[model samples]
Target: MISFSPTEEQQMIVSMAKQFASGEMRKIYRQCDENGAIPEGVIDTAWKMGLTSSSIPEEYGGPGGEHSAITGSLIAEELAWGDLSMAMHILCPALFAYPILEMGTESQRKKYLPLFSDEKYKAATSGLIEPRFGFDPYSLSTTARLDGNEYVLNGEKCYVPLAAEADLLLVYAAEDGTSHAFIVERDTKGLEIGEREKNMGIRALTTYELSLKNCHVPKENLLGDPRGYDFNRIMNCSRVALSAMAVGVAKAAMEYSRDYAKERVAFGEPIGSRQTVAFMLAEMAIEIDATRLMTWEAAWKLDRKEEATKEASLVKTYADDMVLMVTDRGVQILGGHGYVREHPVELWLRNGRGFATFDGMAIV
Candidate 1:
């Protein structure tokens, strides 16, 4: 029989992460959102927790902990519950490090993994989403052509987290009609980092658009080098991560609304005592739990090295809708209060709406 219960170690890690989320992320989320920036001290605190570097091997100057997708999903949900923007920003380096750790050549790991093990937060990110009407990760518009010792890259990417500060970027592009990732240094010629983007949600997390015109990277910079990495598997991992985050965001909204309904009286009775409000809360709880379970299943498949494209895709789609529904209900429950910036429900609603377009913005 299969079990979804986390291991003892996993539980301990989750508990630690939960404390950090509630104690640190929650305290300043609104301020960060308003300012459109997360405090450097907060990011450094999270980095000190070794959230992103713990999985690297001892030889690479890390704790050599097992890297499990389920554990990643659990941590992701809790962090996102505290605040989506801070959660994404805290985990941004993982977007670059994890991929390389899992798929990069031995030399690549030796060269890059150590950078993440530093005491300070290292800025590294990925570029996958293109700024187009119908963007598809598998069928990217960015193109890379191998020429002698270098690969010439030409394309535009948007919604790249920390693009302005990232010292390294894993840029995905189509190579001979196949999607592949190329490691480009920050100062690479023809790689123009655009101004920060203003989005509807996750406002605290800085993102940028990039223009690559004949950008050249050493041929060896291709991830996994001689044998290319599995692009599909990478996408699946990202889907699972995003799905878990959706569960977190939805759960936060549900709990907040449920508490409010208990205290806010209408007709001389608490709003939660009413059937309509109670039923919405019940539905929100059920759907959030369902999505979390689905996300866990996908993460489990990834840990087992099983093909999880269909499962990941299904959970991602369901979570995208579920988060929007739950967060909107959160605002609806608060009536006029939800529309105001003072409450977090409106912020969550905005963040929830962007999940559909958040491909590769997160990863497990």
Candidate 2:
């Protein structure tokens, strides 16, 4: 039986996240988005919440609280409700730590997992989403060829979040017709990072393009050892996280438009009282709720160690469309004000447009 109810701990986590989002993140999100930079203090406060460390095993220098995918989805929605770019910046470490915890060898876990537990925010990111048209994660353009004790990587990757500041990167590539991830240190030779990308949305979160020209790493850096790892599962987790973020952005647009419609006068009455405006708001709410439920179901399956590839894809596709529609409608409902900078609906709509291509920008 599926239960939608949050446990006591999950409720507490949600409350805490909500408080932070409403009080801190929401206040500064606009400024950060405009400046194209997130404040270090924001990242520090979020890091102190232990969103990443609590999941690591105590033996591996963590809080021993264990990972909960469903709880994580809830928290992600709340944080993203505050701000998308800041949420990604704050949780960027998970893009590195979770994969290691899930698929790394015992030695690899011992060597790298402890780095995420420090008191300050440490950027550890994942390298996926290459720079090319018609990209597929399963058949990465980045190739890792074995040369005795080291694997030589050759390809270019783009949209890597926090690349400039990350202490380490988990770069995914194709090896012998199979997908695998390698742990690459920040200072690897022959790895040239491009200038920060100026994108249409999520601008506050810095992304970079990387050229790995014969960048060699030790054979031991291959995640999950000789048997390889479950790349699909990791992809599924990413899909769930992205879907949750879509829900957050959509919910924000819907609520803001709804409130504006209620207050703004039209023909000597509130616009929300009209049939067209009321119906649009209702549809937006329905879609947001539906998308969130799909995300929760996918997360729940992941928590149970069940395969959620199809479900994840389902939610991601639905959310990608749903967010675009909801945000566009939000702009439409607001008429002229929606397109203006003073309101955030236009910003939300711009950000929503990129959801179709936002792979590896975040993880759960």
Candidate 3:
């Protein structure tokens, strides 16, 4: 019996996340987008919510809460509804923590999991997306070879969130044709953090390009050493997280356009009363709900510790199209007003366009 209904605790988490999104993130998303920087205070406020640290066990200096993909999806959608950039930025630490928590060795967990429990926001992130055409996660261009006691990494990575400030980075590379994650510490030799990337969307969340020229990390840094971790499962989790976020973005666009249609009158009648406008709005609502359910189903599969590659991939593909359609419809409904910065529909459209490229940038 699959239930889309969230548990009471999940509902509580969603409500809290919605408040943060509406109360905090919504207040400054436009300015953050325009300035290409989110205020530190806002980031600090989100950090206090324990969004990333609550799932770790008490032995790791954390709050000892269960980690659930479904709960993470619910929280992710609400936070993304507030703003994608801030939402991604706030959750970036999880990009590093969750994998280690789930798949790392005991020594790895003892060393790294405690870092996330700190009072301040820890700068940690992952590197997976490369800068190239026809990028595929399975066949990574980055290569790693075991040399002596260290793994020599060689490749370039782009769109790495908070790379400049991060003290730790979980860099994914192809080792003997199998993709694997290596824990690379900041200041490691041959690991060059390049200039911050200028992206078309999610502009406020600073990302960077990286050059790893024979970068050497201890063999012990290999995630799930002695036995490799499941790269497919990680990718599935990432897909579900991003898909939920797409639903959130689309939902935001739909509700805003729907409200605008009801209020923005033309020829003494609300545009929402018109047949074409009503149909478009109806379709947007339908697609957004459909995508949300798809996201939840994938997330539910993940929580069951089942293989969710097919479901995750399907939802991700659908979400990529769904968000673009809904946001474009939002712009269409608003006419000229949607093209301008005065309204957030244009911003949502811009942010919505980047979902297809946002793999490994988020996770649950």
Instruction: Kindly report which residue stretches of model 2 are placed more than 4 angstroms away from their true locations once superposed.
Output: 226-228
lDDT tens digits by residue: candidate 2, 67-94: 8778888888988888989888888899
Note the clash tally of each candidate.
0, 0, 0
lDDT (0-100) at residue 295 of candidate 2?
Answer: 97
All candidates: CA RMSD in angstroms? 0.8, 1.0, 0.9
Weakest 10 consecutive residues, lDDT, candidate 1? 225-234
Cα TM-score of candidate 2: 0.98
Per-candidate TM equals 0.99, 0.98, 0.99
Candidate 2 lDDT (Cα, 0 to 1) = 0.90
Model 1 error, position 197 (Å):
0.4
Q: Report the poorest 10 consecutive residues by lDDT, candidate 2.
A: 224-233
Model 1 misplacement above 4 A: 226-228
Tens digits of per-residue lDDT for model 3, 90-123? 9999999999999999999999999999889998
lDDT of 1 by residue, 1-364 (tens): 7887899998998999999999999999999999999999999998899878889899999999999899999999999999999999999998889889999998899999999989999999999999999898889999999999999999999999999999999999999888999999999999999999999999999999999999999998999964648888889989999999999999999999999999999999999999999999999999999999999999999999999999999999999999999999999999999899888999999999999999885458
